[model samples]
Each structure stands twice: as C-alpha cells, then as structure tokens.
Target: MTPPEHGILGRVAGAVTGKVVDAVPVEEILEHVDLDAVLDQVDVNHLLDRIDVNRFLDRVDLDRLLARADVNALLAGVDLEDLVQRAGIPDVVASTTGDLLGRTLDVARRQVVGLDAVVTGLVDRLLRRRGPAPLGPVLLVGER
Candidate 1:
C-alpha cells in the first residue's frame, strides 16, 4: 500500500481499537491478553464498528476538557508576588534555588572524585537567598 493509505489505515485502526478497549471490561481485556499486547494488537476499525461516533462526539466538550486539565489549574494558582520574590537574587549569584540545589549536587559528585567546589558555591547561595513563598504541594490521584 501507498504511504498515505497506510497512514490512513493506521489512524482508523487506532480509533476503532481505542473504542473497543474502552468499552471492554478491564478483567476481560486481561483474560484475552495482557494490557500491552491488547493495546498493540487491537484494530481501531473493529472498535469503530462497535461504537457510535455521533454519540461519542456529542459527549466531548473541547473547551470544558481543556479547562479541567491540571496544567491550567496549576497556572491559575501561581502567585505573582511569590514569583517576583523568587526571581530576585544577589548580583554575584547566577542561579535560582532549584539551580543552586542542582549545582550543589554536581559539586558533591565532583568532590567524590577528589574535586571540591562546594564551600564557595554554598556561601554564594546563602548570600543570594531571597525569602520566597513556599511552593504548594503536588497531589497525585489514580483513576477509580
């Protein structure tokens, strides 16, 4: 088959297979094949045949979906004042708290090989410390 034809077939197969996978119970999917095998082998065209496209499309609201995404919520929670404080540092320093932490780790690794850069770096980091707000905790949730 031509490359274009192959690509189209792949997309169709993916859509159908995805639907089939979603509709099938998790236990039944495992009975047929492991998760990876089922994901790799299921044909999307077969899935499409068993599901209603119009109904599926009707159930999806693109705007509402994007609004519910975690990244958007995180961005909304960002405090401008906290960001401004974090951005300021002593003139001699060339790093943020995260950058200093990474640099300190690198220095420690080098020290293990008889090369030390920790003392000066630590002093610089201390001098550059800006009282920034505490970052909020991240919560991870599994699907029910």
Candidate 2:
C-alpha cells in the first residue's frame, strides 16, 4: 500500500482506539512514566521563556485572589517579638536623637554667630560717633 493509504488507515485506527480509551486508562498509562525524570530532562528556562506573561496576567483577578488569602492568619504566623528583637529600636532611637540634637546645636551656633556680628557692628558705630546725641530720642548709634 501507498504512504497515503497507510496514513488514512492509521487515522481510522487511532480514532477507533481513542473511542475505547478514557481518562482513567490515560492516567494509568501515565502512572508508568517517570515524570520527575522527564522534567529533569526538560529545559525549564526555555519552557518559561516561551510563556506569554501578559496573557497570563490579563486572565488573573488580583483583587479576588487577595480576597481568598487569609491575611490575619498569615500575620499570626510571623513572630513579632523576634522581629522587634532583631530591629534594635533602642540603638536606632539613640543614633537618631543624637543626629537631631547635633543639627539643632549647629543651627543655634549659626544664629548666635549672626547675633554676635550685629552686636559688634553696633558697638563699633557707638565708639566712632562724633555728633551730639539727640535728647529724648530713641537713638540708633552713629545715625546723623
């Protein structure tokens, strides 16, 4: 027989055989296959690279998925005491307080320096004044 005749015969035989077989028999047949060995032979990175992530994300409902999650139960699994112990809050607070106080003192020093300049300028002008001071007037030193 020709190859076309063989192909037609094969399709007819496959259709007849597929009608007799079901999912349970398919599962039994697959039970004999070593899935772990098959997976080990496959390139996972190549397989993942072929997947359409955007199409997968488009089908996902994030809100509904999150709603199904037990958040309080998840939180309960976390050890808060352990987390706090690991955080070292006292050391952090001390370092932060020291930095804030240092910054504040620097600003205060700048303001004091500015005040000293103003006071020194006033004193120099008063010492250099030549004209007679106005009587009963609120006199700015050295003003004509």
Candidate 3:
C-alpha cells in the first residue's frame, strides 16, 4: 500500500473530516444507521458468558432495594399459606385446630343431649307416657 499521507493535504483532509463529524447530529446518524445489521455483528451470548452473577449480586444494595420496594405489592404477590408451610407452622396450626375443634364439638354435643333429654321428659309427663321418651334415636336400644 501507499505510504501514509503527510504534509498540508493530509492536515486539510483531517480538519474537514473532523468538522463534518462535529456537524452530524448523533440521532440523525443513528436514524440512518442499519441497527439490525450492526446488532447481527454483536456476540450477545459471549458477552453474557463474561458476566459474574454472584459478584454482581454482591455489589447490589439489597437493603436499599427492599426499602424502595412496595410492601403491599410484595405481600399481594406472596402466597400466605405457602409461606406459612415453608416456615414449618402448618403442623402446629393443624394440631391446635384439630384439638380446638374436638373440644368445641364435645361441648356442643353435651349441650344438645342435655336439652333433648329435658324436652323428652317434659313431653312424656304431658302425654302420661312411659319412663324417659328416649334422648336421641332408639336405634342403639333395639340393637342391644
């Protein structure tokens, strides 16, 4: 190839090129550029392979990020039952609930049985019927 141009002609050419470059608006230049053709020349996967995710995370300000976060939005996104199960609370809740339910049913059953016997006795006396008009069903008595 020819030797590098020097002297007055090269300096004039360089000055004119610099002026033209300075005059072109970057946005107009970008509009004229073939962006798809430029992107096709890039190696996206190779660029991504060079990133250190752990090191990147280490540099992140998690406390600051959390401070800026919408607590209500985050709560809305969460599954409370899943979170409770993950924290190992479901077994305790289930056992406590089961015990509470058993106690409640026992109290209710006793109340109903007592009320039923009282009503039966009152009806038996009014009709002048036999001893105890049976509390609940007579199914068990006949079976015996």
Candidate 4:
C-alpha cells in the first residue's frame, strides 16, 4: 500500500486511539498533527475517482465466509460438531487454530482496506461529477 492508502488506516487508528487518549499528552500531539484533521484537509474523493468498482469488489477477501465452523459445516453439508472435531478447536488443516484465525483476520483487514479504497474512489467520483452544491440547509439547529 502507498502513503495515500495509509490514510484510511490512520483515520481509523486515530479515531480508536482518540477515544482513550483524550486526557493524555497525545492531545497536544493531535493539536500539532491530527489524522482526522489531515484527512479533512485532503480531498479523499479525488483519490477514488479512477478505480473500477468491479475490480475493487473482486479484490475483497471471501475466506471469512467459511472461517466459522458452523458456516463451513453448513456450506459443506456436515454436522458442526463433526466439523469442529475434524478441524479441532486448536487446529485448522495442519496449522494451529490461532494461526488460521490470524490469517483469516488478516484477510478481513485487507478486505476492509479494499472497501475503503473503493469508497474513497466513489466519493471522489461523486464530488467530481457533481462539482459543488449549495450548503443551504441546517436541518437541526444546535445551540453554541
């Protein structure tokens, strides 16, 4: 992944960290350089403008669909317990269950990254296609 690709991950990591770091010195670091602020400053829509949607979807990880014993058993027409025993709680195929789980999670993460890229592309396309629109309505008025 390139620097721009990291933007999506950075935004997610920052938001997750921010919730727990509000009172820490990290706030000072954020004041100096905030991921969300940086994301806002950039036109993410611009980055997504050129991607092919079909190709993007093809890159998504589908292994997670069978990562669960129940799901795998159902798909393969076997009993869940039998499947579990065959692929034990601590083993999947030949590797440790934890290793299999980790790989599955890695695939899921990559899928998420692919999805984010597609979304960013779609946003860029829409922004470019629509040009600019009037910001006229303030539906819910809030007190300052």
Say which candidate scores most in TM-score.
2
How far out, in Å, is residue 137 in model 1? 89
Q: After superposition, how far is residue 116 of candidate 1 from its true place, in Å?
A: 94
For model 1, how does the per-residue alpha-carbon lDDT over 29-118 read when each residue is reduced to its tens digit? Answer: 778666787688889889889998899999999899988789966779898777766877443255576688899999888776443335
Tell me the lDDT of model 3 at 95: 93
Sorted by lDDT, highest first, which candidate order results?
A: 3, 2, 4, 1
Runs of candidate 4 exceeding 4 Å displacement: 1-95, 129-144
lDDT of 2 by residue, 1-144 (tens): 235766978878877767757534888778888999988999989999999999999999999999999989999989988887799987798999999999999999999978976776687588986555343235644444
lDDT of 4 by residue, 37-135 (tens): 788888778878877888987987668754644855566865768878876764555577668899999999999978977776788687785544223
Clashes of 4: 2
Q: Rate the local accuracy (lDDT) of all candidates.
A: 0.71, 0.81, 0.85, 0.71
Whose TM-score is higher: candidate 1's or candidate 4's? Answer: 4
What's the candidate order when arranged by decreasing TM-score?
2, 3, 4, 1
Q: TM-scores, in order shown? A: 0.21, 0.43, 0.40, 0.25
Candidate 1 has its poorest 10 consecutive residues by lDDT at 133-142
